[model samples]
Target: MTDRNRRFLLKARPNGMPKTSDFALVEEALPDLQPGQFLIRNHYASLDPAIRGWLDDAPSYMPPVALGDPVRASTVGVVAESKAEGFKAGDWVMGLNAIEEYSMAQAGGFSQLIDIGNVSSPTHFLSVMGAVGLTAYFGVTEILKPEAGQTMLVSGAAGAVGSLVGQLGKQAGCRVIGIAGGPAKCARLTDDYGFDAAIDYRGKSAEALSDEIGAAAPKGIDLVFENVGGIGLDATLLHLNRFARVALCGLISEYNSEHYGARNLWQLIVHSATVRGFLISEFLDRFAEGAAAMAKLVGEGRLRFDEHIEEGIDNALPAFLRLFEGSNQGKMILKLI
Candidate 1:
């Protein structure tokens, strides 16, 4: 373990897409571990869009990252120092840590030990079997429960959670339609991920996208696993069938937008459809159950997910910006080691 730590701190709250000026890189001495505290040498930091929301000094599920504090993120690492029982040096763990070379965590907190024997890769804990997996699982099975023969729409269908959600919808016997940005991703949605149909939402207005959605779901949308909101969601809302269920997961499109223009909310009232905002944290107690189910599927080769890993801590800001730029190939991860 190094005597010092490198951190990507929030220097300023961004007005739109974050830039280098919004952050500051600093090196600081690692402090002595106190009783009940354990130090982890982070191997990889998960770069999720949710972290973007945390940068704003607005109301959210978690507090915004304080200026000069290391940006909050989920990281997988090996314990390097432990003053706590049930944790030891070399033990692999994952937790809501920070974008840094090392993070200090406490026992009985959000951090949990990982069974490397069962995991295909430690990074999988940050992808298919971790928060992303749980988000797709509970967001589908628990929240937007789909019935056989129903039509399900997944926005950001090529994303980490969206990809898994599409496959699960298929397994549940719903005809799944995916909305991605490009022809390449749209093609993979059907060819690789088994989505019944794929809609490319790029370079299209809300009306144009809605027309495509109508053609894709001629029977009307019975369920929506929405990730990218704004026009994408507004378009989807226009096709909601009576009593439709929408698992409102994210609004990535509006994250960097100064003007939030979602104009089709009246569709909800028109169709009596339900939209429930989903946060995986709500199902924290059942995370193990969700992880086991997803792991089994991955083990049997029934699940397919992707990871777009960018190497080095120095590239953290650029790597994170790829998420909003729609350039990441899969789950965004920063490999520090």
Candidate 2:
């Protein structure tokens, strides 16, 4: 094992989209583990849109990552040493391990031992069986409540969460329409993920998108599982059916911008539609139930997921930036091992 720990620390708060220079990679000697603490050799770390929100010095679901601190991220690792009860060496675990080659933590925090017996790849814990799946499951099954024969639309439909959202909508018997950036992603949405139709929002105007949405869902959308929250959302709003529901999951389109507001919000009133924003953490108490259901779907071959992996801790910052640039094809993970 290496004697030093490699980590990326936040150097500056981002103004818009995060730049690689906003972070600095540093190496430090690993410390001795204390009683009740376990040492982890992190193998993989998740890159997510929520990490962008954590960089800003503003009120949010969690505290911001302080300058000079290791940037916060969820990671999967194997326990190399442990003094904690119920956790032993060689056990695979998941936690808020940040971006580092090593992490030391107590049992009471976000760390939890995970079973990888049934999974083909442990990385699925960061994709289909992890937070991405939980978000998609709760957002659609509990919040959006899409019905059979109804029409459901998902923005960022080719993403890790959005792809699952579209599939879940289909499983619920809804006619699913996806909105993604490129022709290939849009094609994958319909051909691969089972979306009934797809809209390529690459260079289309909002008016053009609205027309496309109208053509796709002529009966109007019954549920909008939103991820991108800019022009696509505005266009989607224009085509909402009466009493429609929208699960406002994430706003990746506006994550980097200062002026981030959606037009056509008035359409909510016109259509008597309901929009509710949620954090996956809010449903933590029932995470087991949701995770179990998602696992069952994966086990039954009813759910599909994808990951875009960047090898090594050295590539962590670049991998993270891909989330904003829309270059990542699926869930982005930094493979440190």
Candidate 3:
């Protein structure tokens, strides 16, 4: 192991999309491990849209990453040394680590050893077997509760969570329609991820997209798994069946913007539909159950996922920015090790 640890510290809060200047890379000596503490050599770090919310000094799910501190992220790594019970050197683990080369974690903190024995890659622990899958699983299975023969619509269907949401909806016997950004992603949604139909939203106006959604789900949408909020949610809201349900997930389209309004929200009243927003942390007690179910589906070849890995810690900032730009195909991961 190297004597130095490399990390990215927040230098300033971003005004819009984060720039590389907002962070500073620094190398410091690895601190001595204390009792009840373990040192992790981070291999991969997850790049998520939620990280943008954390950059601002605002009230939300968790506290903002304090200025001058390493940016917080979910990471998979190996224990390089340990002084904690239930952990040992060489054990693989995942936790709310940081965008750093090494991290010090406590025994009963967010850090937990992960069993990657049945998976082909360690990155799966950060994708299908991690919080990404857990969010999709609980959001779809528990929140939406889509029934067989119902028509379900998923926005951002080509993304990591949306991709899984679409597949889980299919497994529940729903006729799934996916709305993605471009033709390639739209094609992958139907051909690769098992969506019944896919709508490309690239060059369409709001009315045009709404018409496309209507064409795709002529029977009207029974369930809407909304990930991209702005135009997509507005479009999906126009065709909700009576007593329809909406699992409001991430609103990526409006994440970096100041104005966010949905024009068709009145449809909820007209259709007597329910729309609920959730955070994965709220289902912490049942995470194991969700993870197990997702793993089973993946192991059985019933669920699918993809990862867009950016090599090395130096590329972390660029990889993160790609999420907002819609350049990432699936889960965006920084391969540090």
Please give the CA lDDT of all the candidate structures: 0.94, 0.91, 0.92
TM-score for each predicted model, relative to the true structure: 0.98, 0.98, 0.98
The sequence of per-residue lDDT tens digits that candidate 3 reaches over residues 1-337 is 8889999899999888788889999999999989999999999999888888899998998999999999999999999999999999999999998999999999879998998788899999889989999999999888999899999999989999999999999999999999998789998998899999999988787899999999999999999888888877888899999999999888888777774799989999999999999999989889789889988998898998999999998888888988987889889999998
Prediction 1 global C-alpha lDDT: 0.94
lDDT of 2 at 72: 93
Give the count of colliding residue pairs in each prediction.
0, 0, 0
Q: Select the stronger candidate by lDDT from 1 and 2.
A: 1
lDDT of 2 by residue, 1-337 (tens): 6679988899999998788889999999998889999999899999999999999999998999999989999999999999998789999999886898899989898999899898887898899888999999999988998789999999999999999999999999999999998889998998889999999998888999999999999999999999998889999999999999999999998888964588899999999999999989989888889889999998898988889999988888788888877789889998989
Q: Could you tell me which residue pairs clash in candidate 1?
A: none
Q: Residue 59 of candidate 2: its Cα lDDT? A: 95
Model 3 stretches with alpha carbons more than 4 Å out: none
Candidate 1 residues lying further than 4 Å off, grouped into runs, are: none
